[model samples]
Target: MDLIEELMQEITLNNFDVGSSTWVDVTYINNPHSFYVRPTSYRSFLKSMQAHGQKLEQQDLQLSMNIVYYSKTLKNFCRGLIYHVDTAKKNCTCDIYAIDYGCVEKSVSLKNMYSPLLEQGLPPLATHCQLANCEPKNGLWKDKEIDAMKCYIGTEKAKLIVKGKTCLKLIVELFNSCPDDIATMLALTGYSTLGYNENVFSRIPNFKQEKHYYTYPKIEPGNVLHVRTQSGKDLDNFYVAKVDEYYDYINNVNNLLAYSKQAQSLRPEDMKENKAISVFVPQFLRYERGIIQKITVSEEKALVQLVD
Candidate 1:
């Protein structure tokens, strides 16, 4: 590989120290401790991907070269950095890092890889990062906490305050105009607690600053609530909000009704033991016609044999 290719490889393989603040799009969040970010500066990678995809459609790329390959996976074609290869196998498979997406795809077939050009000189688009000065409450990240973290930053860009670097990930604080940074927010939410990372501990906003940040008043006794009155007579009227719970109940009923309707619609006459229907094969990510060989009515499950 040439100098640029070598440099790019080194940069991608190592975590780049970013001791500054920048705007980043949060790509993946496994937990508060681990996540991926695509900085605004790396937005050009998107254009490169677009052009590469067009070329892929034209069938104009080689099948394999240096460390990089255009890999086709269940998720579709993307630039990949080869992580592992088994040359001994008759039909070799490779483990590759999906550079733009920041995820490792394992056992990718050799046939699905294509040679990549070195001219792009683009390093991995996604930067691995961890929320600094925060530790999970139970010394582990659970699904509930992960879900909460996802809900907090759903599809939104955040201000990334990169504090330090680890071997694999950058230690950072991430937030988007809340009462506190994500690290503190996790602690406040009882999913995590503040750790003893001096780099971030000293930088954490004080209580005065936290109070200055906008937060809704807690719903408690003796809180004044204004309501529109018939004659504008009542100034202190309160109402408990149940809009979310009400909608959740309605949705549950609707889903139950829909499921019951579908189950009933699958009558013996409508769908016999050997009924033919279009089935979506998730494995191949496509639709195919199949014969229903067996149906477990109670379980709402079916054994479908593809017509082939």
Candidate 2:
């Protein structure tokens, strides 16, 4: 079948790969501590997932197995689109960004792309791209991905969980991964595509939405698959690693600035410094309030310092 037909099919462990941009239901887990360590019976888990996918379709939102049809028409020069569906509350949020961004429980100034009108015919799918001329071809895609790109275009990266270990391959699919179910795993809290890091996982606004580009492995008719959420500890570790990485980056920037200053002071023959193209570039120290001040600029690099 063509792409459109695939998106319209009932979601299942085989046909649709579904994940929450925020949280997965924990009602199935008996003990939270042994969350990742224990194996989940694949049979019961698949049944639960299938039920959720069907609920979303009945609500009128169309989900694609892969966003290829939408992304192909959207160009990266513009912003990306992100949509959050609170199935429990039956509410949705949409956002558009020209650069890196994440969403919270609140709303933004952009028009509400989530509409009650899409319940008819073919509904639109989410994408991180924009179509040219604010118009798209008559296809299975939604208008927000094409015409309403003045906001943001967003897509989640995914990961696969199988045999109690994440598949090592770059691209993962569900065990019964069909062309129709393009499941992208989105983590709602402090994590990235690398899985959860407990120390570094922060609840900061833009830092949410950890996309796992994974696929599921097929199971025997009677066998079970233990699919569970990442442990809380792993979530924090992700943040710990991130903060350490930032510190290293800051130190490297300081060293480069010092070298640039020294080279500029040397004699023309000794340093051969090109006045037309200064080596030092200006940058800022970003914080919760945003760019507080410019820390480095050309010859003023030595004046910048970040304190813990």
lDDT of 2 by residue, 1-308 (tens): 64324433421122111221211111111111111110122222222111211111324433111011111122221112222223343344322221111111123222233232112222211111111111112323343332222111122222222211111101122211222211211111111122232212123445556332223345579864332221136655521112233323322332232223333342333221122222322332211111113334444432311221
List ranges where model 1 is wrong by over 4 Å. 1-19, 49-76, 86-91, 177-179, 197-308
How would you encode candidate 1's per-residue C-alpha lDDT over 1-308 as one tens digit per residue?
Answer: 75555545543433333566878888767787667787665554454442332122113322222234444442455666553555567767766666566556667666666555434534455666778888877768999989988887877779998776533466788888677888888778888888775333355555652121122346799866542112223557433323333222222221222122223244444544566555556553234445788776633677876643
Q: Which stretches of candidate 2 lie over 4 Å from their true place?
A: 1-10, 13-107, 110-114, 120-308
lDDT of each: 0.57, 0.23
Residue 157's lDDT within candidate 1 is 79
Error of 2 at 56 (Å): 20
- Please give the distance, in angstroms, between residue 3's alpha carbon in candidate 1 and its true position after superposition: 17
